[model samples]
Target: MADRRSAGSRSIAIVGPYLSGKTTLLESLLSVTGATTRKGSIKEHNTIGDASAEARDRQMTVEVNSATVEYEGLRWNFLDCPGSIELAQETYNALIGVDAVVVVCEPVVDRVLNLSPLFNFLDEWEIPHLIFLNKMDRADVDFMQVLHALAAVSSRPLIPHQYPIGHGHKLKGFIDLVTEDAFQYHSGACADPIPFPEELQVEEKSARQEMLETLADFDDKLLEELLEDIPPPQDEILQDLKMELGADLIVPVFFGVAEEDYGVRPLMEALLREAPDPSATAERRGLNDADNQPIAQVLKTYYTPQGGKLSLVRVWQGQIEDGMTLNDVRVGGMYRLMGQQHQSVLRAGAGELVALARMDQVKTGDVLTAHAPAPDLPVARMIPQVYAKAIEADNRKDEVKLTSVLGKLLEEDPGLRWEQQGDTHEIVLWGQGDIHLQVALSRLQRKYNLPMTTHQPKIPYRESIRRTTSVHGRYKHQTGGHGQFGDVFLDIQPRERGAGFQFTQKIVGGVVPKQYIPGVEAGVRDYLARGPMGFPVVDIAVTLTNGSYHSVDSSEQAFKQAARIAMQEGMPRCKPVLLEPILNIKIAVPNDFTSKILRLVSGRRGQILGYDAKAAWSGWDEVVAQLPQAEMHDLIVELRSLTLGVGSFEWTYDHLQEVPERFTTQVLQAAWNTK
Candidate 1:
């Protein structure tokens, strides 16, 4: 396939659960195809996709890595996407510009269950995909059982193109039912055809017939021939597989041990011949005309040390040039993404993903289609589920530097957010979780040399009144020449929970000068802003009634002082309460772990809504719940523990509820001391 064929080369995202051999498969693909000098083992920490220090230390694919291989004159870019749901966006982002996905799964039933999330993502996106059953050598499970497990959540027919030649630990390789041949792992790089073992020949023949029957159902003529006892031609089987996959009606399953590279050759051949190319894909996005208008999407961004932010884009229409201005948009610097590095390229075409340098205002999902009338594409949205606050050195001079350092760090990761928490003088840095926040903070120190300290963020608790009462506040200072005198009477009452603070004036006789009333209200507000507890006071209504003032010496300051004193006298008597934040969370884990999960929920004072089967999960279930934000820190740790390091979740702010009495004491005490 020529680069300009435009119906871009078929791409497949190799994704699944963590430690399920996603990176190992990538290493295998690169080695068998001779893309690299030698395959780097994870144990040696030298694989391409698992390049980061943290990733190597953990022996996992933390981010998606795309690698290109030229096979049989057609270029195939396989996206080695991370299997962890925590870094799912890395997979989602890769899926955006590809033709199809190849979901890699393990042989164990529990491990196979984790494939749901990837399944759902592909199904929801209508991405034509195939499921690769990897690591056959480590399992004791039946092959059909694994197929049935996948088919349980699969809406489309999970037709198999190949089957394992043996079961469990004795499994050596696969029987390509389509080819009716046995593939043995002569080396850890590829499958080599060999004589079938006499003992398994009968089983292999039955599987080959079953696969042929599956392929027949996809074609009208073949289906008729199959029913009529006519053998379908090899060409017909290949054509039917291509049709079903292209129509997104079926997900073909390919069995392989990626670590041994047992079945990659056949998998690669299927991808090149059966998977639809870029032209068919882009057409669905309404990209047809050469002059229709230029349309591209910013899929991801990276900052270049010399040129600045690199915006990786997938152009769907009209061509981009070196200097041409499409509408008001100027041609930004163009570069080709070579793994993590970028090299300047003259131009990249429609259906091609390219990295353009230094496009600052562009973000992750910005669409640049038809410059004049932008085509409305559904926005690719990712919610940052977890959050933790990061703080700076907390020293006087370092505070200013921290602010400056954070400003630049934020440019790279929009999921990273921060707030000054102004009055408290605490710079709160928020992110998806502890690791996410720390990663940004680490970059600040290592990449930008900005040293900082951080702590688990304090909840922004607010205080309000449950009842109202009236009180008087007076301040008199008689030193000499001009004596100070001021007095105020107030009627305080409760407002709706979120209504916030409100003040009203009702002066019947102007007992206190009308000019001095403004000062009195200001004084009342000053007390409310800091509150009886050291937090913003809300849901309270105050009415200014009768008061006295010295005609000559009572200044605005004196009236303000009197009002402040009056509020201080009345607030404590009104039955003040504290409010805390509640977050709605959704945790997905294996189905077997459900009972224990609910138990853990109760321990955290959390309310579990329900347990529902989620197809996108591999060997798991998802539980939706609502828990107080204050109790969230160790929830992920507990979730992993309960599921044996297989479960994960995402959360967001739900609402606010009154803090229970047991928790209110601490809230009020902290507030009083701060006041």
Candidate 2:
């Protein structure tokens, strides 16, 4: 309807569920724009979007891939993000700086629920997005049914911008509802205009009227025209689509087969016409344009093979030049990226996504400016880690190198977290799921040559006594000149749960010297470090009732040895039991899968505390339960499988509970085997 071309640059993210053809869509966009000589296929392992070694090996996207192209005198930066639920952090982080989003999905109604979380995030942030129903050539269900299913999950109204005109397994073309123009698809070429199909005239008219009614909900002029049975002009309808879509009020839906590049060009044209400019995005983000200072935010970070660090950032407000200083760190170099390949650029203006080399002080989610202090821009919060593994270098000499490389790894992917667990005395890595950690471990070996050995993290088990006992110990050694002589009596008992450790003493006059009493407590603490069950001892108390010491040869060291002897003899008699850490977990899942999750918890020896509707989340339930840490290792893996990969949970240490009699032996044997 209008030949208007937008000015400046625009950044859009392609995001959806795994295997929904997001990367395929990116490949088609790059190919149609002539940015690449030819397109790459996922099966052939040559696609530019999933270019990383880890991604190629797994045949999936593990991180965000940035590519730039120019079309119709407008520059567009497309961020192809990971589709797996475990790698959603990469998608969320990249979405923060984008002007709009293209949500790619299949036409299967059963799988449409997978888009709920993505829609929820976009709506919450007020980010404008449109749905591209890819793989229409394989469609087996009615398009209207799929659209209705999508509408059920999204908060915003769904308006069909174009209606598919072919039957199942053969998508011929689509009719543009705004213009009522029909087109036919061709291989690797733009669609050709064709006459309207008389057989489908009624369906096309109804669909067009529905789209107009949805748009009219926002514009009174359109509403009057529709109410008075007067047809709205083509320009007015296009304007309404652009305004409503840009304001995030309505999601316009388009259908196509991305593999055949059928609707790719039309999707690109719609984006060029309907998407908002960078200035509009800046205003929406509250960024001041008149400040004349450069402000940018890091969407991702990378470490090159040559030991170079690159920060991929979006220039939100001002132009950034090579060697410019930001946050006390000078930008070493500036470049635009197409997959892993970098093209040198001297300066990048607002709305451009570029890579800045060697900004060591900057990190993902950090806002950078040319001035002294950078402003704080909102960033996506990392999802809670649901799986963990204890990791160490395969070669002992590589331990220090592993530690150093892991820092780089975490900087590159904030969703990953690592820590030195004090209780278990193991280096543990936590992530969204098993696959997420696997990709990180692969990076360790591929990038840094640091191969790692991983296993389920220890449960941080502890030991506590069930009964009380008093035992005496004495140490008398005579060596020709000076001899060691000391005696002690220890009373050991169990404290209440979570009371921790306690130490006290009662002595008669001059029985045990005051100077040597600390030795007794110190020795007891050392013994508690590894108790009868081969774990740290907790919730226990020790007291020294009476002891005799020789005035000449007695010392703290002698007393310490005597106290150790006492504990070694008395602890076995106290009947110590194994205590496993229990986690208080709150699981979030759609209501349809609530019952299945409850059964899953039961199978894991977890006690269901209660469940209720998750606050502010309709059709979702939050189940509260207490599960042993040992059972938590793979809970996320199964939970996601049961709930279409959208279920998640958050947990904290609840308390230590005694292991069941039946499982105690297995637990102890496993611990011993590891040692």
Best by TM-score: 2
TM-scores for every candidate against the unseen true structure: 0.88, 0.97
Q: Which stretches of candidate 1 lie over 4 Å from their true place?
A: 1-8, 139-141, 167-169, 188-190, 290-293, 323-332, 393-431, 478-483, 583-601, 607-626, 636-656, 666-675
| Candidate topping lDDT | 2
Residue 309, model 1: Cα distance from true site in angstroms = 1.8
CA lDDT of each prediction against the hidden true structure: 0.73, 0.91
Q: Please give the distance, in angstroms, between residue 23's alpha carbon in candidate 2 and its true position after superposition.
A: 1.5
What tens-digit string does per-residue lDDT give for candidate 1 at 486-532?
89999999888667778888988778888888898899889987776
Off by over 4 Å in 2: 1-6
RMSD to the true structure for each prediction, in A, is 3.6, 1.7
- Residue 438 of candidate 1: its Cα lDDT? 55
Q: If candidate 2 were superposed on the true structure by all CA atoms, what would the RMSD be?
A: 1.7
Q: Candidate 1 — worst ten consecutive residues by lDDT sum?
A: 1-10
